[model samples]
Structure formats: structure tokens, C-alpha cells
Target chain A: MEFLLLTEKCIWFGLGAAGFAVLFNVPPKTLIYIAFMGAMGGFLKAILMHFDETNVIISTLCGATLIGFLSIYFAHKTHCPPPVLAIPACIPMIPGKFAYKMMIGLVNLSGNIDHDTYTQIMSETVNNGLKVVFILMSIAGGVGIPLLITRKESSKGMRLRKRS
Target chain B: MIAPSPKNKEIKDLGNVLLNVGAMLLSSGASTGRTRNTISRISDSFGYSSDLLISHRTIMLTISDKKNDYFFNNLKRSAPHGVNFKLLSGISRLSWQVVEEGLSVNQINVQLSRLAALKHYPRWFTLLFVGLAGVSFCRLSDGDALDMVTVFTATVCGLFIRQEVHKMKFNPYICIFCGAFTASLIAGGGLKYGMGFIHEQALATSVLFLIPGVPLINSFSDMIDGNLNNAIVRGLNGFIISFAIGMGLLTSMLIYRF
Candidate 1:
């Protein structure tokens, strides 16, 4: 049962990533490569959270970083720019539910409410909103890692190697 | 000094082609490093070195051959940035061809136009997959079988409206706003009727499709590369799109009071 649920989760995220890839109009050939990468990311995050009991932010950062490194490798094999592959692969991890809940909470705050309720709702909204911001920050930091480390050497070297 | 350099037809033509390539890469949503490097590759293949000044909407290019003492410069402004990875990938491949195949300016130009003519997946195809994406989002959030159906219907309709509004030249933020509003409105029915296991999840996740994901990713990616100016511009662009989506959902929430 645990294995089945995990598989379902990975597949859904992979499908979501592929869907965004199509919307970005990535060449059809790249869809499967990116989907596999996305599934791996989801799988890794699931393992971290379920086994080690790590938090979502760190788990996501690790997953995104893995995708980043994978994108560089995949980009070379496919001869596409890294950003073309990396950006769409990262979409499935964006915290949509948290963002929406935060926005809804904010909207509710402007309405009639008691002081305690207002404070309670404000805290929840802030918490959700912060999660959205930090997760985004982590993703940014995570994906940036491969570029920072590999780019100085790889940008020139990698293309030359590919052509030769 | 640059003015003292002699002019040639090839230099001028190469200048135009490089600027067009640079502008296309910038407006197609590539990171600054990729844009700068690709321009460098092509210009180097032409025996010139390019100095690019890239902004959110314009790319200024100056190509100079150190040995020949000739230089040409041009600046091109492009439409608002749109995510077209095909354009990025195609130009990356073309730049390599310029180096390896030793293509001339005219040949590169022909290939570029060919690249531009390449067709994306049909609109219906994008719609269907994006809807599936929405359903997946619904499932991830633990929405039931029926909620998946509701979210898919909402997503397809919303994306169609957004695409139509976009073709008519609506501001991109307005297009996103319209898309979010349509999706949330459709999903809001579930919330109003309390039909699904987690009705608000349907309403909430429905707008996930409007998230300015690629822009956010690139903005941060650019920020990490020490290109602070373009990074900030792209980041602001992503934030404004998110704000528009929030407003759209807020509008829907007010209507249904859910």
C-alpha cells in the first residue's frame, strides 16, 4: 500500500511537470526526459519526508537541486539550453495550495470578524504565505547551485566537448 | 576608436543577425548567461566578439573584430517576454552550427526563419494536458475522483479563455487574471454546493495553472548569476502576474462568498 501510494504521487507530479512542459511548448522529444526527472524529484522528496521526517522546505530544495544538476546533463545530451528543461521541471513543486490558502485568508481578514478570530486568521495566513515565499526562495537557491558550480567551467567546455 | 574602424557589408549584416538572435533569446525567456553566451558563440564564429547589453525588453549588440579593426552595432527591442523554449533550443543548436558548419550570415538567417516557422503542439493539445495537470494538482491535494473532474473542466475552460484573450493582445497580466478568474469561478461551484470531499481544494488548486512558474524560476536563476538588474525585472514581472492571479481568485471568492 505504501509503495502504491508513493508510485501514484510520483506519477502525478511527473504528469503535472509534463503538462507544464507542453504549455511551454518544449520540443516533444524532451517531454519524457523532463517527466522522468520530475518523477525522480518527487520520489526523492517523498523519501526524505516519509523516512527521515525532514521538512518540506529542505526536501524541496534537495529535489530542485537534483533536478538542476540533471537538467545540465540532460541539456547537453539533448542539445537544449538548461533553462529550457530546468524551469518547467520545477513547476510541479510550487506550493499552490499554500499560496491559495494564504490569499483566501487575507481576503477573509478584510471582512467582519472578532479580534481573536482576526488574530488567529492573520497568523495562519502569515504562516502559509511565508511557506510560499521560502519554498520559492529555496527553489531559486536550489536550482542556482548547479549553475554556480558547473557554469564557470562547463559553459565553454561543455559546448566544445559536445561539438567535438 | 570604433568609428575609425572601416565598415563592410558582411559586418553590418552580421551585426543585424546577431542582434536578432540576441533579441529572440532574451524575449523567449532565456536566462541572461545563456543569452550572453549564445551571442558570444555566434559572433565568435563570424570572427567578431559581441558585447551585449540586455534588458528586460531590449538587447543592444556591438560586434568588433580585433584583428580587422571593424565593428558594427545595433539595438533591437522586442515584444514582452514569452516562454518559448523552442526558440531558445533552436538558437542554441543554430549557434553550434555556425561554429561547426561554418555557415554564413545569410544561411543562418534562412535557418532562423525556418526555426520560427516550427509549429508548437496544437492548442487543443496544450489545453488537454494542462487540464490533466490541474487534475493531478487536485489529486496531489487529496481531492477525490469527482473533484478531479471539476478541476479538469475548470482548467481547460480557463486556459482556453486565457489563450483567446492573449491572442487578442490583452496585457499578459490581464490574460492571467482572466484565466485565474475563470478557473476559480468554475471550481467555486463546488465550494458553493459543498460537493467535493475538500471543496475548497478544488477552488484553490484550480488557479494553480496561472502561477507564473517559469518566470519565477528564471528570475531566481538569473539572480544567482550576478545579473541583478534583469533578475530584478524578471522577478517583478513574476510577482505582478501572481498579484493578478490573487486578484482574480479574490474576485471569485467574493462572488461566491466561499
Candidate 2:
């Protein structure tokens, strides 16, 4: 059951990414490439969290960086912009739960300014809200670093090689 | 007005085509750096020196044939935001072909029109996949099987409404706001009626499809590439979409609470 759960989430993540690829209108040829990237990133994050050794930010950074590296390779092979692959692949890491909780907490706090229950909710809200921002920033930065180094040069070189 | 020379007329026409292509790229959510480079490369292939000034909403392009002393300038606004990687790739390929293959202006125009004419996936197909994606997100977030099924159904219904609203030409914010509201309402209602195992996960993942992943990433890319204006603009746009989504989700919760 444990092993099955591990693989199951990854498969679902990949399928989810394929759905996003279609939504984004990526060419069919590269859909599998993107799904693989998404699966790897999503799986790696889940594994790290399972270990409980690192927090959400670290795990997300690792996963997003993996997506970035693979995006570079796949973008080259497929001749599409790296963003086209990286964006959808990274969507699975967006921390939707935190964002939703933050909003709910805010609504409760607004309705009851001084209640003890509201105070606890407010603290949880702040924690979750901060996690959402930090995790998102980590993912963006993790992917952006690789893209900055390779994306412009590889495309330029490809153009030059074609010209020659 | 002085009668324009033939070379001036030719440059003007090419300028217009370049403007159209640039606007299409920007509107399609191409990063500012990519849009600028592609436009410049395309103009270079046509033997014109060009400068492109891109912001979040507008592109200002000037094409000059310095040897013949011809200059043409045009400003165009970006179209609505949508992501079509095939279109981006097609335009990228077209730019390279123009540069290396020495395609003529008329041939480039033909290819551009063909690429532009490409359509997104069929509406039903998109709706189905978006629903599946929502279900997948629910699972990834550790939602139980029941929650996944609930999210899947809600997402499909919500996205269908979004597609229809878009067809009717509503503002994008309004469309997303309504879509999120509908999706969350379904999920929230389902949980209220004891349809899902996890209420939070169902409500959370149902709106995953509306997350604006591309723009959020592109804003970071734009900032790193030193296109601050475009970066700020894209960032604000992403933030607004997020606000719309939050508003939509809250609206459903509020109704559910009552």
C-alpha cells in the first residue's frame, strides 16, 4: 500500500500536467516530455516531504530545479521555449491549500476580532500565507536560475548553427 | 503630403506586418525578451534594422532601412492573454526560416497568417482535460478518492461556464471570478451535503486550473531578463488574477457559510 501510494501520486501528477499541457495548447509531440518532467518534480517533492528532513520550501526548490534542468534539455530536443514546458510542469507545486486556508482564516478573523478561536485561526492563516509566498518564490527562483544560464545561449547557438 | 516612394511603401508594409506579429506574440503571453528578440530577428532577415519597445500592454516597433533612408514606426496593443506554445514555437521557427532560408516578405506573410490561424484544442476536449487535471491536483494534494471525484465534476462544470463566458466576450477577470465561484460552490456544496471526505482539499483543488501559472513564471523571467516594466506589468496582472480567484473562492465559501 505504501509503495503503491508513492507511484500513484506521481502518475496522477503527470496526468495532471498533461491536462495542463493541453490547456496551454502545447504541441502534442511534446506532451509526453512535459508529463515526464512534471512527474519527476512532483515525485521528488513528495519523497522529500515523506522523509520529513526538509521543509516545504526546500523540497519545492529541489523539485522546481529538477524541472528547470529537464526543461532545458527537453526544450532543446523539442525546439520549444523552456517556459512552455517549465510553467505547466511546476504548477503542481503551487500550494493551493495554504492559499485557501489563508483566505478562510482571514474571513473568520474579520468576523470576530477578539475571539480565542479567531486568534488561533489568524496565526494559522499567517503561517500558511507566508508559506504560500515563500514556496512560490523558491520555485520561481529555482527555475529562473537554470533558464537564465542556458535558455538564451542555447537558442542563439541553435540559430547560428542553422544559419551556418 | 509628399508622395511616398516605392521603397518607403515597402518598408511601411513590412512594418505593419512586424507590428501584427509582435502584438500577436505579446498577447499570446510570450515573455518580453522572447517577443523582442523574435521581432528583431525577423526584421533583420528582411534587411531592415528594427527596434522594439515592449511593455505589459503595448509594443512599439520601428523598422528602418538605413541604406535607403526609409523609416517606419507603429505601436500596437497586446491582445488578451492566452498560452499557445504551438503558436510560440511556430513563430520561433518562422523567424529562423526567415533569417536563414532567406524567405521573401510575401512568403513570410503567408506563413505568419497560417501560423496565426492555428486554433486551440477543441472546447470539449479542453474542458475534459481541465477536469482531469483538477482531479489529479486533488490526488496530489492528498485528497481522498471521493474528494477527487467531487473536484473533477466541479471543475468540468465550472470550466464549461468559463468557456461559454469567454465566448460571450466577458472581461477575463469576470470570467475567472465566475468560474472559480461556480467550481468552489459545487465543491463546497458537495462537502456540505457529505459528498467528499476532505472539504478543504476539494475546495482548494477545484480551482487549480485557474492558477495563472504562465504569467506568474513569466513575470519572474521578465524581471531576471531586466525588462522591469514588463515584469512589473506581468506581475500585477498575475496578482489581479489571483485576487479574482481568491474573491471567487471566498464568494462560494461565504454563500456556503450562510
Candidate 3:
């Protein structure tokens, strides 16, 4: 049963990645490669959360970093730019729940400024807001490092590497 | 060393073509590195070296041959941002082939026209997949079957409205705002009526379709790649889009009192 649930999560993550890829108009050939990377990243996060009992932030950072590394590899293999593959793959892990909660908390505060409810909502809002920032930053660092490293010195050594 | 032969016209035309190609790639949201490399490679194939200055909204190109007579043009325009991998890869391949196969400028022109005319997938196709992607996120978050269906339908409707508004050439921020509003409104309505067991999950996942993943990712890579100017541009673009989405979500929550 545990294995089944994990499989299901991985599958859903892959499907979601495919949907975004289509919207981004990714070339049909590399769609599966990106989907697989997205799925693996997402599954790794789930495994960390459920099996290893890690925090969401660390888990997501690891997953996004993995996606970042794979995106670079695929970019080289397929001769497409890394962003063309990495960006959509990272979409499935965006912290939408936290952002939505942050919005809700702000809206509630505006409505009831003097209540204890307001205080609780404020804390929740701050927490979620911070989570959103950290998650995004982690994803950025995770994905950016690989591309930044690979991009340097490439113009001189591998002029035709990506044009094939 | 100015050669006053008929080849002067050919050189000018070649310069024009190179400028056009650079402009198209820039407008297509290709990063500065890729755009510069592709332009320089194509011009080199024709025995003319080129220089480029690219920003988020403009491209400047100067093409010169052995005689050092320079032809230059600058384009000022804001490019609509959307990622199209096929076009990026196709143009890259074409530019490389220009060097490998020694294709003439006229031949390159024909290929450029073809690349520009490449067909995008239909609106309905993007809508279906974008919606499905939202639903899949819901599933990944452990939303129940009913919640998944709710998210799926809400996202599909939202993206349909977004595509229609985009077709009308509405500003992109407004399009994203409207899309988020419609999707959240449906999800909120479903929650109030007791249709889905997970209110927060559905509301959160339903609007995942508008998360601006591409711009955010691009902004990060741009900064790390040390294109700080372009990185700032892309980061600002991502910020405004996020603000628009927040407005849409908040408006829906206020209306529904959730």
C-alpha cells in the first residue's frame, strides 16, 4: 500500500508536468524527458516527507536541485537550452498552498483588525509567506547553479554543442 | 577596401536578414547568451562578423565584412513572453547548419520564413493540458477523487477564459488576473456548497496553473548566469504577474467570504 501511494504520487506529478509542458509548447520529443525528471523530483520529496520525516522546505530544495541537475544534462543531450526544460519541470513543486494561505490571511485581517482571530491569522500568514519565499529561493538556487556552471567556458570550447 | 561590386546589395540584404533573425529570437524570449551566440554564428557563416547588444525589450546588431563597412540596425519592442522549445531548437539547428552546410543568405531567408510560420498548438489543446496539470497537482497533494474533479473542471474553465482573453490581445497581467479569479471563484463556490471535502487544497491547487513558473525560473538562472540586467527585467516581470494573481485570488475570497 505504501509503495502504491508513492507510485500514484509520482504518476500524478508526471502528468501535471506534461500538462504544463504542453502549455509551454515544449517540443513533443523532449516532453517525456522533462516529465520523468519532474516525477522523480516530486517522488523524492514525497519519500522524504513520509519516510524520512524531513521538513517540506528541505525536501523541496533537494527535489528541485535534482531537477536542476537533470535539466542541464538533458539540455546537453537534446541541444535545447536548459531553461526550456528546467522551468516547466519545476512548476509541479511550486508552493501554491502557502501563497494562497497568505492571501487568505491578509484578506481576513483587513476584515477584522481587533479580534484574536486576527492575531492567529497574522502568524499563519507570516509563516506561509516566509515559506513561499524560502521555497522559491531554494528552487532558484537549486536550478541556477548547474546552468551557471555549465554556461561559463562553453562559448569557447563547445561552440556547436547545442546547435545539433 | 570597399568593393564596389554587385555584392554590396547582397551584403546589405544579409545584414537585414541577420537583424531580423536576432529580433525574432529576442522576441521569442531566448536568453541573451543563446541569442548572441546564434546571431554571431549565422553571420560568421556568411563571412561577415557581427556584434550585438540585447536587453529584455530591444536588440541591436551591427554586421560587417572583410572591408569593415558596417551595417547596423536596432529594434525597440517589448516581446510577449512564452516558451516554445520547438522554435528555440529549430532556430538553433538552422543557425548551426548555416555554418556547416554553407547555406546562402537567400536560402537562410527561406528557412527563416518557414521557422516564423511554424504553427502553434490550438487553444483548446493548451487549455485541456493546463487544466489536467492542475488536477494532477491536486492529486499529488492528496486531494480526494471529488476534489481532483473539482480542480480539474475549475482549471479547465479558468484556462479557457484566459485563452479567449489572450486571443483578444488583452494585456498579459489582466489575462492572468481574470484567469485566477474565475478558477478560484469556481473552487470557492464548490467548497461552500459542500461538493469537495478539501476546501483549502482545492482553492490552492486550482490556481496553480497561473504560478508563473517560467519567468521565475528564468529570472534565477539569469542572475546566476551573471546577466544581472536581464535578470532584473525577468524578475520584475515575474513579480508583477504574481501580484496580478494575488489580486485575483483575494477578490474571489472576498466575494465568497471564505
Task: Residues B54-167, candidate 1: write the lDDT tens digits.
Answer: 888888888888875677878899767888888889998899888888998899999999988888899889999999989988888888888899899999999999999999
Per-residue CA lDDT of candidate 1, range A44-126, in tens? 87778777663889998999899989988998788887777877887888888899889878888989999999999999999
Full ranking by DockQ: 1, 2, 3
TM-score of each: 0.95, 0.95, 0.91
Model 2, position A113, has a per-residue lDDT of 72
Q: Could you give candidate 3's per-residue lDDT for residues A95-159 as a string of tens digits?
A: 88788788777777778477777778889999999999988988878777776776655544465
The CAPRI class of candidate 1 is medium
DockQ for every model comes to: 0.79, 0.77, 0.66
Model 2: residues with Cα > 4 Å off, grouped in runs: B1-3, B195-198
True contacts kept of each: 0.86, 0.78, 0.83
What does the lDDT read for residue B85 in candidate 1?
A: 85
lDDT of each: 0.86, 0.86, 0.81
Error of 1 at A7 (Å): 0.8
TM-scores for chain A over all candidates:
0.92, 0.91, 0.89
Positional deviation of B221 in candidate 2, in angstroms? Answer: 0.7
Clashing pairs in 1: none
**Candidate with better TM-score, 2 vs 3:** 2
What is the per-residue lDDT of model 3 for residues B84-189, given as tens digits with 9 covering 90 to 100?
7667777887886887778988898899899878887787888888888998988876688788888989999998888789999999999999999999899888
DockQ of 2: 0.77
